[model samples]
Target: MSVAVDCSSEETADILVESQNSSLLENETEDIEEFFNVAMELAKNAGKVVRSAFSEKKNINTKLTGQDLVTETDQAVEKMLISSLKERFPTHSFIGEESVSAGKKCELTDNPTWIIDPIDGTNNFVHGNPCIAISIGLAVKKELLIGIVYNPIQERLYSAKKGQGAYCNNEEVTVSGQTELENALIYSEFGAHRDPEKLEIKFGNMYNIIMNGHGIRAQGSAALDMCGIACGEADAYVEYGIHVWDIAAGILIACEAGGIIMDPDTGGKVDLMSRRILCASSRSLANQLKNQVTPQSFPSD
Candidate 1:
């Protein structure tokens, strides 16, 4: 039965706005699907590059300090990722760790950008530690909407598209719902820096976690650490002196898997370029960690 009712102008306007919002959501979903499929392929291809070079001795070089290492595989994989993605998305922007190290500006704009960290755990990769990852994250209009982190050595692929939840190797996964600080397992990888001042701050934060939390482990790979939170293997992760590429992909996957992320210092929305991060299984747990952890800073990426 149809009712012949007169609608107010405000009601009509609300309907129009709702319709527009629905249309926008649908379009964004379509774009996400297209982008996700392409991203999946790129991650797999990048994985192949990493996998092929895993056991081979690499030409490793130190960056900034003797502790910060970069290998030939890192450069090759970065180039491969940029080239392939550029071929498919010429207009897209990029922020790659290797590229930035090579003199490119580490800038983020409103344009669609691909943040790539070809070998997130380069030190681990060099040590044949199987804890490395090919991390790719997409930010459009300065908001992260897609993330892909592939550990070719471990064959663990974690991914997410905004609103669709997170996955590991095609299986949906979630965070361990341990909200208490005493019960949480924490991941902190920050003692490698030679700067004694930074090391002191990093270690102090670690000390707090150790005293308060159930236990701690240093994964050496921030991307995988966040994925560990997403897959319920870990309860929390915190890092200072990490760049955008290190946590961008992992942030989305972890959040989609019912985890929470924030600035360890402020407990606010994390500034992707700020080089600080805290990820936890729940808001209560994250807030608890934020309260205990010592704050530290680094130059933005």
Candidate 2:
């Protein structure tokens, strides 16, 4: 769990050279490991803040829509995470949910940047539910390099670095390898968007999955839902009207776990900034989901 970079050691350098996606030079590998370590530490500290504030009723404010709630704890946690991360990587940029709520820009750059959701399941957290987590994703040159999601309540830590395998609680994890949709467990989220047309599309997709798949779950947190797929707890996940922070970490985690994520609009390719995403335990299952379920365009807002 220690994030200390040891690329200087001959053994560490050999391992990186032999790993998947091992194209990175020694310096880049060291930089990425440093970032990953800093991010994991920040996520753990943020989890503590979340746990200490979970039991009490806190002030909540609406953002963009009534369904989107932001609590004082959310703001405080983001401030803490950003502050701590910035101190460690001063030149790197950050795009956090609270900063966006405060009218700051959410644009991503090709530089080393941190995409953070201080509390991914804010609504669930507000309701005293434990289905929440701190999602931290590190993107370098516009490519996700490291992802970490910590569910302090459940004490589940899911993380992955590009070219490295995915891990849950330090154990290597993988997708369920369910190729058939009918017998596959699926996960999806009803986003904050309440537009009737969008809602109809979401419900219709849910209905199709329900009648075809083994079961469907609305886990409230996109990060956790995708992590579920990464660890084989669920076979697939689909969502629309979500942001980069919501799915950034999950994308890397799922892919590192041997899962496939696609943009249904792009004929099954991936676009990180796409507001819509379809993911499954395997490439075959992803294709099945894409062909079986038609995607409807929603207001991107």
Candidate 3:
């Protein structure tokens, strides 16, 4: 499908091209536009740093538990981004995963804040896998307003603004219109560290889909998985245990791409910091999946 976008303003054009969201942000102040431009530039710069680190020796470390990992690249990129953003917008808040892991609480104030994951999918990066990203999201008054997710290896940049459409690589894209489970290609994340009972229920849901002739993928990056759905490459993506940074930008992209996002546990609109999520191309599919998965209960770990 073809999407029309105004390429008059360079900044708007760049965002439109990178995002493929058809709708342009209306009446944005020059300051907001400048901030977005800086964010996009910083995110791309961080991607370069990550690529350089990937090509050489990386100092890998563990976080949270043995299952979670971090790298020197993650910290360095975040520091660079935070510093640059602070230099430009000193009054703005910065919330970064690495910084948060270092025991810095990211409290949202009235000022604008940038939510960043300098190198998301550090596990993939550490393992020399290509499914990692740099996620940058902007929020004012704790409300998410703009977001950008870039995968350096793939050179795919997804972005969106509040009330505007989503985009990928300058093409206007939308979620697939597949309404049935049998026709859907779903993406999910499952790992060894997850609770066994939860795994069982998740497996049961997988089994139901398998019986319906649906396809399932377990790409490591949550940001990319949601982007995949946004670009209509995947019909849905669901994750039970994830943090806000993982899905923040992705949720905006998906919504602007005309997809539905919700908390899988409560079947409600997703809060910015929600831990569990169910995202689908359409509300019908989301409700169907939620219903099928709801009857099964998993023990909390």
Range of the 10 consecutive residues with the lowest summed lDDT in candidate 2:
1-10
Query: Per-residue error at 196 for model 1, in Å?
Result: 0.6
Indicate the residue-level lDDT of 46 in model 3: 89
Candidate 1 clashing pairs? none
Question: Each candidate's root-mean-square deviation in Å?
Answer: 8.3, 6.2, 7.2
| 3-122: candidate 3 lDDT, tens digit per residue | 111111322432232223433334556666798789989888988888888867777778766768888889899999999999999889887888888999856554788888888788
lDDT by residue for model 2 over 187-235, one digit each (tens)?
8888887888878888988888898889899989999999999899999
Over 4 Å off, model 1: 1-26
lDDT of each: 0.83, 0.80, 0.74
Rank by lDDT, highest first: 1, 2, 3
Candidate 2 lDDT (Cα, 0 to 1): 0.80
- C-alpha TM-scores of all predictions: 0.91, 0.90, 0.84
TM-score of 2: 0.90
* Worst lDDT 10-window in candidate 3: 1-10
lDDT of 3: 0.74
- Per-residue C-alpha lDDT of model 1 across residues 134-166, encoded as one tens digit per residue: 999997767677899999988999999866789
